[model samples]
Target: MIPGVSINEILTLTSILFFIGVYGFITRKNLISILISVELILNTSVINFVVINKYLYPELLQGMLYSIFIIAVAAAETALAVAIIINIYRRTGSVAVRETETMKH
Candidate 1:
């Protein structure tokens, strides 16, 4: 697909993206930044599914179905995370990662 691109190249790109997301998730202190990182991580899986299906299983729709499902779940997760982050900000005046621990009290 895409003229001459191979699955190995595509997978390599996804792996890089995934690791960047993981690094962001680990280093970010803001809740919104962490959410963005999580979204990025989820998107790599979606890309992998689509790429694999297009290159290896062109006869089946499983890849498309799985990608769609992942997108829907990611959307729902993003909405919920945003809502929770907003609530936390309203209560604590900060959306920092450490601030969330106060919610346990």
Candidate 2:
């Protein structure tokens, strides 16, 4: 939509963001960091959906609807995740992935 930007460029950007999110998710040992990584991953997908829909089917609202649904789900998931993390922190006193392993009991 910009003067020179193309869908390919947008998709490439999203792809890079996706991999960065994946890397963060894989290497992060803290619950908060993992949650942030997951959010980043979800955001990239949302962007992809919207961009593809806008470029290929500008007449339809399906992509926009789907993205709205995704955003709602992501919000709910984040709330639940934060609540769980807080509970775990209160119980174990640490949010580190390795340190919270005692929760199995």
Candidate 3:
């Protein structure tokens, strides 16, 4: 069973996750790692949106709609990025960010 927690705890947890995502975004080099970080950031926003919608504006679907759109966009972004990375690897023979510089001119 989940422990009884307050709003403050939830917010703090979200904040920590957001920071972790930021750190991953800054420190990771692989395309997939950055994509996961982006999704993590989006998850934080979606959680906040749902919480506020449920508590502060119980009569509207705006937040839910926004969250849905964000999720869709994140999915599309990841798919497109992965496709590009695959193409890049097939042509260049490597996915490492540091090695893509040879084609930049």
Candidate 4:
């Protein structure tokens, strides 16, 4: 850990990772890849939230708590999404996202 590093560095790193994840989410055409990108983005924000709260507000871990909730929700979401994806792949020959959109309501 470099003592010379500033808070801005941490923020920048978090933002960069978030944007990369967003880009992945947008560009990926496979459901599995998109799900992975979502997780990446969620984790990026969690890292930012936890770091900000840890350094700026030590008494309250509200941000950390929110991150935990997000993790749980994301896990549940992934479970359902993967199951759906597997079903789709079994029925359809392709894992393309465009083919799965018809199932959406």
Q: Which candidate has the highest lDDT of all?
A: 2
Q: Model 4, residue 43: displacement in angstroms?
A: 0.8
Runs with alpha carbons beyond 4 Å of true place in candidate 1 = 103-105
Candidate 2 TM-score, C-alpha based: 0.94
Please provide, for model 2 over 14-105, each residue's C-alpha lDDT reduced to its tens digit, 9 standing for 90 to 100: 99999999999999999999999999999999999999898889998899899999999999999999999999999989999999885566
| Candidate 4 or 3, higher lDDT | 4
Each candidate structure's TM-score, on Cα atoms with residue i matched to residue i, is 0.93, 0.94, 0.84, 0.84
* Candidate 2, superposed: residue stretches over 4 Å from native: 103-105
Ranked by TM-score, the better of candidates 1 and 2 is 2
How many angstroms is residue 77 displaced in model 2 relative to the true structure, after the best TM-score fit?
0.3
What's the best-to-worst order under lDDT? 2, 1, 4, 3
lDDT of each: 0.94, 0.95, 0.82, 0.86
Clashes of 3: 0
Model 4 Cα displacement at 44 (Å)?
1.2
Which candidate tops TM-score?
2
Q: Write the per-residue lDDT of candidate 4 for residues 40-105, one digit (tens) a residue.
A: 898888888787887788798798898899889989989998998888899987788898677556
- Across 1-105, the per-residue lDDT of candidate 1 in tens digits comes to 687899999999999999999999999999999999999999999999999999999999899899999999999999998998889889989988887774564
